[model samples]
Each structure stands twice: as C-alpha cells, then as structure tokens.
Target: MDVSSIAVVGIVLLIFGYGLFKRTDVSDAFCEGAKDGVKTAFELLPTLCYLMLAISMLRASGALEALVRAVSPLTEKIGFPAEVLPLAILRPVSGSGALSLLEDILNRFGADSFVGRTASVLMASTETTFYTVAVYFGAVKAKKPRKALAASLAGDLSAFMLSALAVRLIFG
Candidate 1:
C-alpha cells in the first residue's frame, strides 16, 4: 500500500490498541459510532435528495446553458471561457454535478486546453458549499447558516475568477 494508506491503517490500529489497553469496549463504541453515523445520514437524506433533484432539473431544463450563454459576453471580456461557467455554477451546490460538468468540459475542450485546465483548477480550489453546509448544519440542527453560506459562495466566486486568471497567465 501507499504510505498514506499504511499510515492511516497504523493510526487506526494504534487507536484500537490504546482503547483495549484502557479497558474500553472498543467494539461497542464502534457500533455506537456506526449507529450515530447512520442516523446522521438518514437525517440528511431529504435535503440531499432535494438538492439532487434541483440540480438535475436545472441541467435538464437547459436553464444552466441559457444562463451561460447570457453571461458569455461578460465572461469573454474578463478572459473567462464560457464553457467553464456551468462548472463554476454547479461546483458550489453539488460535487457530483460539478464533476460531470467538468468531465464534459474536458471532453469538449481537450484535457490540456485552457478551458479544461481552468475547470480543473476551479474544481480543485472551490468547495461544494451548499451541499456541505446543508449536510453539516442539518446534522447539527443549526437553522441559521446564512453568513456561512454567503462567505462560502464568495470564496467560490473568487476561486472561479482566480483560476481563470492563473490558467491564462501560466498557460496562455
């Protein structure tokens, strides 16, 4: 195995051994943790489902494409490729959706093309902000995440702009 994988296994073994040495019921603790994880997953299920449905409908309805086209002139003026716009929009809400769009960008533009590289950088730099906030806050039962959401989205926008600039400066 790779060093990282071996290190993780070693750490887990150490923790398990320490628990045993401390006379802790490790198996029961593990089972309790698994049950809690399952409960958290169930609690976040509805929000995840709703977000997936919304992302699907957004793509299927051609709204995303229309939005990209509508903003193309502005993006072009700013040296951003219109093709990467969908990735920027979808990245904040859904990782899988953003990945699928990134794959499409790579396929259409070629992996080494400026647009493809920019998409990759943007994907790497940004977070699935909405999905993360929804799952984490939902798990913690926090009702007000407006500030966090705003900050996360602002960071995403900065990442999008900076990725485009970086790719252009380095590759163009």
Candidate 2:
C-alpha cells in the first residue's frame, strides 16, 4: 500500500528470485554466521557474569533503591510511569538486571497494561547499555567512539522519552 511497504515486498521477491537462480551458498554462510555467534557468546560469558554479579551487589547494597527514589521525582515530572521507574533506572547499567525487573512487571501486569507496554517499547528501542558499548567497541578495538557513542546513547534517551509518552497516550 505504502511506498515502504511496496519496497519491502520488492526486496523479498528479489531475494526469492535470487535464491531460485543463483549459485546459493546459503547453508555454508548460515553455518558460518552461527559459528561466529557461538564464539562471540562464549567470549562474552565471563564479562556477562561479572556485570550481573556487580549489578546484584548494587541491588543488595540498597544503593539502587536509594538511587531509584532519588530520581523518582524527576522522572515523575517528565511523565514516566511510576511503575517503570525501577526498570528505567537499571536499564543504563545492566541489561539482565533491567530485564529481570521488566519481566516481573510484565508478569504482574499484563502486556497490554501501561507498565508492560511501556517496558516492551523501551526494551525494543534501547541498547543494553554499558555491556553492548564496551563489547562492540572492544571487539573492534576502537580507541575513541565519542561521536558514535553519543548518537547511540541519544537514541536510547529518545526511546525512553517516547515510550513513556506512548504508554501515557495509549493507556493512561
């Protein structure tokens, strides 16, 4: 119907056609990609464990609770749902920690509910924060990613703002 919709259809048709005619190395390529993904996962497991442990420690220390309370007033002013305040605070530092909070919220409140819908949108658009940034840049051995990091982090902030607004508008 729309130009973008037509473009997507065209791309899918082209891919299908190419698969029918070309010397396809799909299996080999797919296997290689899977292998690379497995390798990356293995390499990152230790880093992931350390991050989770540190985040757990922060949660245990009560500092995270205090931090959430401290920012609650400001986020309240900006229209963030009170229910999402904990996930919002945890999102920037650790993805697993944030997801645990998000999952609990989603389980307690249905996905169609304001808090769950907000979490869904926020999770989709935002990065996994420090872990992703560190691993991606470190993998590439990038020295200075000032501009790139700014752009990525700016998008995360925009997602947070837009998701909050969307939740209020759709379910408030």
Q: How close is every model to the real structure, measured as TM-score?
A: 0.62, 0.58
lDDT of 1 by residue, 87-168 (tens): 8877987776676677667887898998889999999998889989888888876689999899988888888889989988
What does the lDDT read for residue 44 in candidate 1? 68
Model 1 lDDT-worst window of ten: 47-56
TM-score of 1: 0.62
lDDT (Cα, 0-100) at 59 in candidate 2:
65
Model 2, span 1-172: residue lDDT tens:
6675999999978975786588677668668888999998787677667666766676679776787678878888888866677776668767766766676668778878877899888886776776677777887856677777788778888888899798687666
Q: Residue 120 deviation, candidate 1, in Å? A: 0.7
Cα deviation at 151, candidate 2, in Å, is 1.8
lDDT for 168 (candidate 2): 80
Model 2, stretches more than 4 Å misplaced?
1-70
Best by lDDT: 1
